[model samples]
Target: MMISDLPADLLDEILSRVPATSLIRLRSTCKQWYNLFKDQMFAEKHLRNVPKQLRVLTLKENRLFLPSVDLNFVPPSIEFSDELSLNNSNNSEEVHIDSAFHCDGLLLCTTRDELVVWNPCLGETMWIKHSEGSKRVKERKPMYALGYENNQSCRSYKILMFWDCDELYDGQVDGFKVYDFNSNAWRVVNYPNCFIMNSHGVNLKGNGYWNAYDDNYVDYILSFHFTGERFIRLCLPPPSQGCMYTSLSVVREELSVLRCVKGSSKIEMWVTTNKMDTSASELSWSKSFTMNFGFPVLVYTGLLIDEDKKVVLCNTIVGDHLRGACTIGEEDKYYSEIAFEGMSLSQPPHIFNYVPSLVRIQEGTELDVFGKSPRRRGDDPPTRRGDTAMCDHDFQFSQEIDDMMS
Candidate 1:
């Protein structure tokens, strides 16, 4: 029997297991399959049933380059794939993305004039216009984060637009706004000026996290809970002295932090021991492994760790000049440079782990959904950063909290 002759449910069961990239290309072959792939129910099934494939995405001059990675090799292997164009319309105008945020298989990208949420795997894009408040602060080019709230089987996605005011956070506190996909509108949200958000933000299980410091210069993890529409602070591992760079990544479904110390070749990896518990009094972190590259890694860079293989794939600087990507293994087990064909290493490109999904951005009236009201802050003990004991305010986020298998 022809594949098209299969029963409707049977066809969905088979197609749901196909990789997203393949499915996207094959959708044009059959009208029935095209409509089925667009069905929200089928998308959910595809998300739950299809195995995830992780790839490295690098953005250069608004161009997206996806490179295929092979971890079975010693130093690991990466090869150039394709340059993804964001412009899917008949107009030939190129899309220039200033920055991009990833959450739940969708990317929130900002350009010189507007913002858009994109599912590159499915070749889908949704434009989000700025609010009046956002336009007034356009010169600042407000930072953005994409996240969602899971209310039972439904997922409500939202975009957070806020300004980075570390220099003036103590005074003239600035408020932030949230753009609800369901409502297709923006609303201002209260901002807590107790801490200053720093560095790039990462999303974990529908929440947004960033490296932050307080007035006392204590560094911690700042988390914005979308479900609660409130900010909460989580603690980091004991601080490292002369730490020149810090970056966060989600590894094996848990949070991981990479600390690169100044003038030192030693890089330490810390993993959180528990899943994200927003209400926990303290988050725990344990040292995973360390990499000694024999040369100081002087800049902040993105990284992905293979827990079982004991290998780390990350962007690196060579000879204090050239930029490149490499894999670092434990105790001299291996170290090798990944060469990308036809891609420039002249500038450091943003790198992150990505899994394609069929999750669609829903549009409708906003639901009156709110999470358990913000947790009451208590007198938590001071969190230690190196030797300094930071006065742990209830809202100050922490570092080093991760998911470690053992």
Candidate 2:
């Protein structure tokens, strides 16, 4: 009864309990393990096993560069492969990343060339084709990004380069093009210039784009939607109207706008909640834990949860700790010794957690969690990122949004 002798179902169950960082090597155990690991269903199961509390990050030390994400909480957990191990000869120190956007369970890295969809968990990757090539990409700086699609699920994702090259979002103000995972194409729609969130990802939903925009000369938090390819604004959130010590980013599947609503003198942390009110809403953020760490002025690089847990993973300067905690009355905090040498991509660490509409893979059927859409066959690709994918990444030609999800 060796490890390979375990039945596929039982093996899958066992694999699901392991962290994603080390799952790759288990393939060498035997043909059975390799097939089980490669099967989409089995892979999905393993993904479910990856605890959301595991924090993934990009590390640049002594020219040994690697875009790494981690699930430090898992047993036997200190895995950091599937990431690039860089060196002086790489000559890439000049091309560095500044921020990280942990979309869904994946990470979006802004590189010298373009916005790349990176799966540090699986070691698979894809680069969105821009007309300027990698050289011109240095000049055209894209500040905000929301990774709507990743092609790792299928081969058509390869054709993504051909279609997306035409949709260079420059000078096309308020216009958006979603990527159709099924059709392997790109579609365009007109939009308005909303807010530009510099250090984090924005909140999202089927309804509106919750962003900061100038309303009559003042910064007003706004939500814009595409009605017939035209920009239509949604109702503004009340609390975000006038607040300084606050932050806005998407959580779960709804638009979560977090602000420092309340706090005690010694332990002060912010409170964030969702703005979606309807059947579509999945999770409502009602938890508020105060913080006794860094000053308010300290630049917050980004924030994410650990595999659907209450813990929020954050990356910051020297005084910051690996895990989230409150330092009250001089008591110490638990910190991981993961050292990131430089600050090319803002020294803040990355935490991937369970979001509002997001759930850690578990008892649910394979339907809720899929890399592809449930829509139909034969149509042009989506013009935006959040569009649907077809069954097993067999994208539909013209699958409507309602039919895809519902």
Candidate 3:
């Protein structure tokens, strides 16, 4: 029997097992394959079939890099691969990427003039211009976040933007907006006293969470529900007498807070026991084990936690080099640090958990609204320009398929 004569279910099973890098090339093999890969059901099934692994994506010198490390091995083996580089094309100048956030297999990068959503696996990028009101606002840094929500019938992604206003009215600011992919337009939203301290927000299960301060200068965990399009504040744990720093992160799929005391050498981590319980009074925070780095060092951010091995990945700066530290939870507390070989010390990297899949960015009404044409990699669309100096290394995907698979 011909391959085309095979049952639809059989075809789906075969395709779902393929690697995402190879699947990108196969999408253009024929119209039938293209349609099959683009189907929402196929995307969900493909994600389920792939074995989940811990991977980190970093930005340095206006380029994107994915570094994989095997925590199971002693001292952890580290490998680096270049992903994508932003530079001047024929039509526009090179763009400077301010910050990036990863959600559901897609990367959202912000430039001064616009925001771009890139699906590295599929080599597809979408450019979104800022709203007219945003352009007129005073010069203050803007915060961006990417999130998605799913229902019985369909799933949709949304981007949220809020600007730090120069002037305050009764200790309140008003530069909150959201972009819905389904609508293909930006809409202003009501955000009372919502000012995020982080450059980007962390997305978990259809909501974006941030470490934020309110009009009264009170710190809290701010949450924005994507489906409901509203904001809520969750109370934080009581502060230490001499707390030096505090930040928010995800630990084992739960909201976690990392606190550093003024005269302490160790960082204390707290995980929320009742994450699904949204009520402020009902939310509970439990103190996890402390990570002692021996000497007092800056704990920039918590990357991820390996539940099986009880290792936590974090970013730290040691004198001149940028390093990744692994804190182990064995009998005797120990930690190890590896310098990120080629990254600059100026721009510290932000790390996130990434899973490879064949998920498409635009779906349903979005596809019909945006033109039906396919956007190639080199297409000359309106671009954002940046002033950072370029690196000397050649910009390309340095690692081979074997390196990534291994």
Candidate 4:
């Protein structure tokens, strides 16, 4: 009763359950097992079977370690595709991230206690005015939340920026602000019921992750219908006290969320069919198979794509531990955990643009309402990199670099 002899579907299921490293090692087990695992149909199924989670890559050792074992898509031809260099000229705006979340194929970044949305595809940047809030003027990361809505005529994404305006570290929030991509401006809004925030920023994946105010004092998934210009709350299964991971993700025809337990091997999957209806709150929590085979640490930090194959591409962090977003002792987790000084020693700048989220939508099309600043698209393919100063330009071996370093 070897693995090769099992039914093909069953064998692929078992293979999908294993980690990426273990699956690669299993390729040497047998030719039949190897071929079965390598099949394209099996690849799609394996991606669906694995958890839809996020992968984080730290800037260490001049490389990015890819962790997609369940070959979801034909791996793109890229070699050590992580280390990127700064043009210095292109980086004049600072583009500091107070808080950021990805939605509708773009990044919503907040800074200066204000909000700025960027479309990396079109190379567009827009400064959205922040609505009036706490008068204290304390500086912090602006965690921006984004979501999409569709109508008979068009579709638009909403950017919501949440921050502490009060000068005091007290829990009372001064105010909340909102930005509409369609109007191309920011509007002030009344404050909603405050909820607990995940202190560490490493766990942020999608922008519009929120909960509805409930009797148990927990947040429900907040949903905005763009066409209706309305807000609805998604009733999610309650989170366990010991759980360190929870995120909103979509599975097939249903909207779902993932909750992971710390120091344990399994993550719970909750799929919803109710769509934006609050009447369907049935107080029932469902369970799914274990993903990663250990504590489901990095759920929303990776990339998941469903095309010819269901591939979850994960970028693993090199050093340090995968910290929880909201920890007990530490708060203020705005994702930009590292700081870099720009060729100067004073005024430390918290660098937030490092973790690159590879979002894939329709190949030829993108949204227009998100504001596209027209720029000549460069046709040059990204260049290969090496162990020197980070750059995309071809560098001839020269002693001038040596003298500059000395």
Q: Write down the worst ten-residue block by lDDT for model 2.
A: 156-165
Model 2 alpha-carbon drift over 4 Å, by segment: 1-6, 56-95, 132-140, 143-173, 181-184, 192-195, 202-211, 214-242, 245-287, 292-298, 304-406
Q: Whose lDDT is higher: candidate 2's or candidate 4's? A: 4
Candidate 3 stretches greater than 4 Å from native: 1-6, 10-31, 45-51, 70-83, 86-95, 131-137, 165-174, 194-199, 215-218, 237-240, 244-247, 275-282, 317-334, 338-347, 363-406
Best by TM-score: 1
> Which model, 3 or 4, shows the larger lDDT?
3
The residue ranges of model 1 lying beyond 4 angstroms of the native Cα positions read 1-15, 68-81, 88-90, 131-139, 165-173, 240-245, 277-281, 317-323, 331-333, 337-348, 363-406
Q: Model 3, residue 399: what's the lDDT?
A: 31
Q: What is candidate 2's local distance difference test score?
A: 0.35
lDDT by residue (200-306, candidate 1, tens digit) is 68888788887777778787888888888888777888877866436777776677887777778888888888867456546689888888888877434566646
**Model 4, residue 21: displacement in angstroms?**
29
Clash-forming residue pairs, model 3: none
Number of the top candidate by lDDT?
1
lDDT of 3 by residue, 35-86 (tens): 7877877887777675553356666555666655576556665554645555
lDDT of each: 0.65, 0.35, 0.62, 0.38
TM-score, cand. 4 vs. native: 0.46
Q: Which 10 successive residues of model 3 have the least lDDT summed?
A: 387-396
Worst 10 residues of 1 by lDDT: 397-406
